[model samples]
Target: MSESMITKQAIASGFKQLMKEKTFDKITILDITKTCGLNRQTFYYHFQDKYELLNWIFYNEVILVLTKDLSLDTWPDNLFHMLTVMKENDTFYRNAINHSFQEEFRNYLLTISEELFCSIIDHIKVNYSMPEEDQKFLSRFLSYGVVDSIVYWVKEGMVRSPLELKKHIVSIVNECKMYATKHPTTLL
Candidate 1:
């Protein structure tokens, strides 16, 4: 990695460590810089604020990992991996969701989910002949459901294993695919 990336990763690591011990609202740039052995100037050079650092962490750790080499065939596996990572970093994520940046986190998930679901819908439409409007509508609808489900899962302490959650989500997705294939005309 480049020096810039290394510096950013160090900052992210410090921020994540602080997140484990304190709520998002309570942690400041000084705390993060101190934890990571960096100065406030370095942290500010890479990120504007703690919230921006939190976003960088989510994008790099979760979004980048989940989206790498992703396709319809690998979507389930990618999602499962994403959930597993979140579970592994349970304290940081739970703390993030419960305190500050909840809406921003949810919005980030919603945006990615919508993009993924839109692509799925586009792929399905090659054989299903759904209207463009319907495809967009269905993708947004599914995205909201999936995002909310994930938020609920995290809020509920992620009691279920990632595999269990993945299985349930895949089952629902498969059912939706089956429905779209079987009743393409009625999917409005």
Candidate 2:
């Protein structure tokens, strides 16, 4: 990685460590810099604020990893990987979900989920015609439901294993696909 990327990763690492010990609202930039052996200017140079740092962490560590060679056939595995990553970093993610930056976190998930659903919908459209506007609407609709389910899962202490959650989501999607296949002319 480049020096700039290395510096940002260091900052992200420090912030994640702090998140494990303290609530997101309570951890200051000074705390992160001190933990990471960097200065405030370095953190500021890479991120606007702690919230932005949190977004960066999600984008780089979670979304970027999930989007690699993503396809309808692989989305379940990708989502499972994301949940596994979140479970591995439970403390940081739990803190993020419970904190003031919850909207940002939700928006990030929504963006990724929408993209994933759009791809699935496009694949389906190859077999069944769907208006562009309807495709966009359906993708957004599914994205919201999936994102909210994830947020609820996180808030409920993540009782289900990542595999279990992935299976549940996959079942739901499969049901939808079955319905679409059975009633091809009605979905539009």
Candidate 3:
């Protein structure tokens, strides 16, 4: 990797390590720079703030990893994998939600989940003759539901297994497929 990439990775690593002991709210830019032995300007050069760093880390470590081999057929499995990753990084995730940027944390998941859902839905090319807005609405609804399920599972200390969550996800997807194939009487 290039030196710039290396520096950025080091910065991300430093922030993650700090998250183990301190909440995101408690961690300062200085803490990240000091942990990585880099000057404050270096951290600023790559990230505007700690929250942006957190978003970068989430995109890189979690979203990128989950979407690497993403396929429409295995979206549920990918979500399960994401849950497993979150479980493994429970400390950082839990701290992030409970201590800082709670809404942003949820919004990030919603954003990515919506993107994935919309992509898959488009690829399927539903022949149900629905409006474009309707398709997008379904995507947004399901994405929000899935993201909320994940947030709730995390909040509950992940008592349920990833497989259990996967099962629920699959069931929901199948039901939506069935619904799309039918002429619904109500959107509610």
Let me know the TM-score candidate 3 reaches against the reference structure.
Answer: 0.84
Best by lDDT: 1
Better of 2 and 3 by lDDT: 2
Clash count, candidate 3: 0
Please give, for residues 60-168, the per-residue lDDT of candidate 1 as tens digits. 8788877889788888998899999999999998998889777887888788878888888788778757888887888888888877888889999999999999899
Q: For each candidate, give its TM-score against the true structure.
A: 0.94, 0.91, 0.84
Two-way TM-score contest, 1 vs 2, winner: 1
lDDT by residue (tens digit), candidate 3, 1-188: 99988998999889888999998878899999999999999999988998888888787767776676777766777777887887888878777767786677688778877888778667655564566787788889998898888788877778888889879977887788676666543444
Q: Per-residue lDDT for 145 in model 1? A: 81
Clash list (residue pairs), candidate 2:
none
Task: State the C-alpha lDDT per candidate.
Answer: 0.86, 0.85, 0.80
- Which candidate number maximizes TM-score? 1
Candidate 2 lDDT, 1-188, residue by residue in tens: 89999999999999999998999999999999999999999889999999899888988878877787888878889889999998898888888888856788788878888888888877766777877787777778788888888888888888899999989988987787677667766766
Give the clashing pairs for model 3: none
Give me the overall lDDT of model 1: 0.86
Candidate 2: Cα lDDT at 37 = 99
